[model samples]
Target chain A: QIAVANAQELLQRMTDKCFRKCIGKPGGSLDNSEQKCIAMCMDRYMDAWNTVSRAYNSRLQRERANM
Target chain B: MDPSASGMGSVDPRLRHFIEVETQKQRFQQLVHQMTELCWEKCVDKPGPKLDSRAEACLVNCVERFIDTSRFIVKRLEQTQKSKAGFSESLSD
Candidate 1:
């Protein structure tokens, strides 16, 4: 379905961006340390995305309630 | 758009509207990703064992204030333009 494709595309973009942010150079087969760092980075990135989304949503809700 | 939509050669208004909203949400999500990345470099010292409450709070406040700052600039610019235009109109009379 289109939704699935959209998700895959977004996931791909997210991974690429995060990988570039976390990985400096292509080391020997993605060493354990690199893998761990990437894993953690991905989680933190998702956390950041969620926090922003929640904050923005609540702000919109507050504005709507006020208006 | 949906493959079905392509096959049908037409997209329903309701589906189109849904897609529009989803697109807007995706843009918001993408900006959040970008901001988080930028702020992480500034506010995050290290990849903790987990994101501490303090770090999470920093991100939330960063997002809120970032938005506030954007709106503030926009409104200020609008007011500036309004005053500038008012001055020009009065002087030209």
Candidate 2:
């Protein structure tokens, strides 16, 4: 249940962001080129998310050590 | 007591532990989602074939600096409140 909810949230956010990043103008349909861009965009977004999570987690660990 | 946590009579000890761990993990994931969107604008110009080294470094730095800035602001606020309290105490005396 938790995993499903998390995936759904990620999907919703990725769709919103990738659409904005990849789709320049409203087209008749999501064309081949547009589809390609969205795929790459999703991959990069997940990369960014992991980088941030790791950085934040290390920062929290460092702060805890100081205390 | 939280209504959500009220029904604990039948909840298994292992399931309770799982719930606690999952809640913490979800919080981390949610923040990652938020920060990714926030930093994507700053770090990424366009989605490329892969996340280039430069953009990856930028995202990492952005996350660290963001947390640093948050801690700095909170410390500053506490200092301000401490000074104000001291000033008011002196006035009362």
Best by DockQ: 2
Per-prediction DockQ scores?
Answer: 0.44, 0.74
The clash numbers for all candidates, in the given order, read 0, 0
| Over 4 Å off, model 2 | B1-20, B85-93
The residue-level lDDT of candidate 2 at A43 comes to 95
lDDT of 1 by residue, B1-93 (tens): 778658645777797888878877777666665676666665565665688898888987887788888889999977887867885566669
lDDT of 1 by residue, A1-67 (tens): 4557545655775587668766887876887887888788777766666676788788879988999
Model 2: lDDT to the true structure: 0.87
TM-score between candidate 2 and the true structure: 0.78
Error of 1 at B14 (Å): 4.6
10 residues in a row with least lDDT, candidate 2 chain B:
B83-92
Model 1's TM-score against the true structure: 0.69
- What is the Cα-based lDDT of residue B69 in candidate 1? 88
Best by lDDT: 2
After TM-score superposition, the amount by which residue B17's alpha carbon in candidate 2 deviates from its true location, in angstroms, is 5.8
lDDT of 2 by residue, B1-93 (tens): 867677865799899998889989888778777888889989987989999999999998999888778889999977987867875467669
Model 2 steric clash total: 0
In model 1, where do residues sit more than 4 Å from their true spots?
A: A1-17, B1-20, B85-93
